[model samples]
Target: MSQGRMASGNDSSVTEFIVLGLTQQPELQLPLFFVFLGIYVVTVVGNIGLLILIGLNSHLHTPMYYFLFNLFFIDDCYSSVITPKMLMSFAKQIISYAEHMAQLYFFSFFVIDECCILTSMAYDRYVAICMPLLYKVTMSKQDCLILLVGAYEMGFVGAMAHTICMLKLIFCDGNIINYYMCDISPLLQLSCTSTYSNELVVFIVVGINVVVPSLTIAISYTLILSDILCIRSTVSRSKAFSTCSSHIIVVSLFFGSSAFMYLKPSPAGSLDQDKVFTVFYTIIGRMMNPFIYSLRNKDVQIALRL
Candidate 1:
């Protein structure tokens, strides 16, 4: 493979990506596989159930729920990306390298998409809490659709940017990646060529996706806190806090694990540790999405009862 340049000078047709499994321990593989399989099952059911519940219950059709529907969709795609192959690897060792790249492409798409949608959700909450009178006006149905479209666009663009750079990276030597999937960092680490530009782009793109959304969530919650403090009644403050707490938890889990994974100056965080964190963000984090954000809400509870 040419160093940082694709054959025929076109970056799009690069054919394969190597995947490193979760562990090489023969004794541990089957047990770990079963654990992840169970987690994947829970993730699918939880996200699907949340989607159906919100769609069927008319009372849940507000902007909050609308954003949530997108969130569930993202989680569904996220879990689907790596879990099936992971399960298969336990049963059999050799996997298709091209298929692995395809999965990485799709998985990267949803990860970027989810970030944009979550940022929009944070902005929506800000408007609803800070400008309650204009809530419906600001987040109208058309606005929701536009945000959703923008999320998809941003996701594809970001993924394309990363994928293009990845195409330029040479993987001729030591095709074995240290991590379970085709994450940009692990992929870049395997490159025998100069990855300075690739590393910069990865940082910039991942930073934009992770930091922008995290900052939006932070600012929104800050304003929400101010608004809650201004309320005269303890009951109202408690209700407001309760409503916001769940979102805070979900945002923390998603962004926190992501930040931990990418923001480190060193990769001393052991591959095993990275695998654990990836599982948290990719699988366990998703299971917690519905539970932390929408499932426990009193409004959703009441809507479910009705």
Candidate 2:
């Protein structure tokens, strides 16, 4: 809640920024810290466990699990990028400009990668379920590799765009970020210079990241659903739905929370709402993925038993 004197762009820039953690209530800090610490522990364990499980099990090396391997990898890295620093913010951490920028860049990179990877997973599922005969040919090792590389390339481009735009902004005023971590919206809110350009970039970049993947998933699932319905046997239909249901749940949770957080105009005094939405994708979403896929997936269950 601290305020700084409004200074001109020519004035001294903020050397560091204070992160006002999830809540200012003294009594809640320790409890919240423990809670998120537990979540982080589970996130690391669940994701890494899945990664190792997939790597060791030769039976799970199809294109679907190939995407799953990368998805878990991204989730692990994504959670690490945000959660540990967020835990420190409970102590009201002060981060240097360089540190904050690094956090921003990496966070942006992993998040965009997650979006693209999820879209690729949906495409993989579509091929596996809707066109079973052509799955291998269409999603060959080389093709899957191309898709994975493309996702990372998009992440790199999006992160660079955001970081470069942030570099142009002057933070000559207050440095307290009213949220838990260094995110695009909260950081933009702290800028002392005109953020019109930054906001435009956020909208364009976030729109493409959110919309394109969403549309891809939507179309893929639509075709998938159509194929599932054509199966005359109830058992076959059920199996097809089962194959896709996990991906659908994951996509819904991730895209729903992320789009809500980024695509809208961040109104003044909305940081609290922003924090809630951010927790869904950043913390809870990552924590839930491994359990969702493992518990729902028969192949993973079989691999675990073996």
| Top lDDT model | 2
- Candidate 1 off by > 4 Å: 1-18, 266-269
lDDT of 1 by residue, 144-247 (tens): 99999999998898888878777776665555566677677677666667887776776788899998888888988899899989999999889878877877
Instruction: List ranges where model 2 is wrong by over 4 Å.
Output: 1-9, 266-269
Each model's TM-score, in the order given? 0.90, 0.96
Please estimate how well model 2 matches the true structure, expressed as its whole-model Cα lDDT.
0.89
TM-score of 2: 0.96
Error of 2 at 11 (Å): 1.8
CA lDDT of every candidate: 0.79, 0.89
TM-score of 1: 0.90
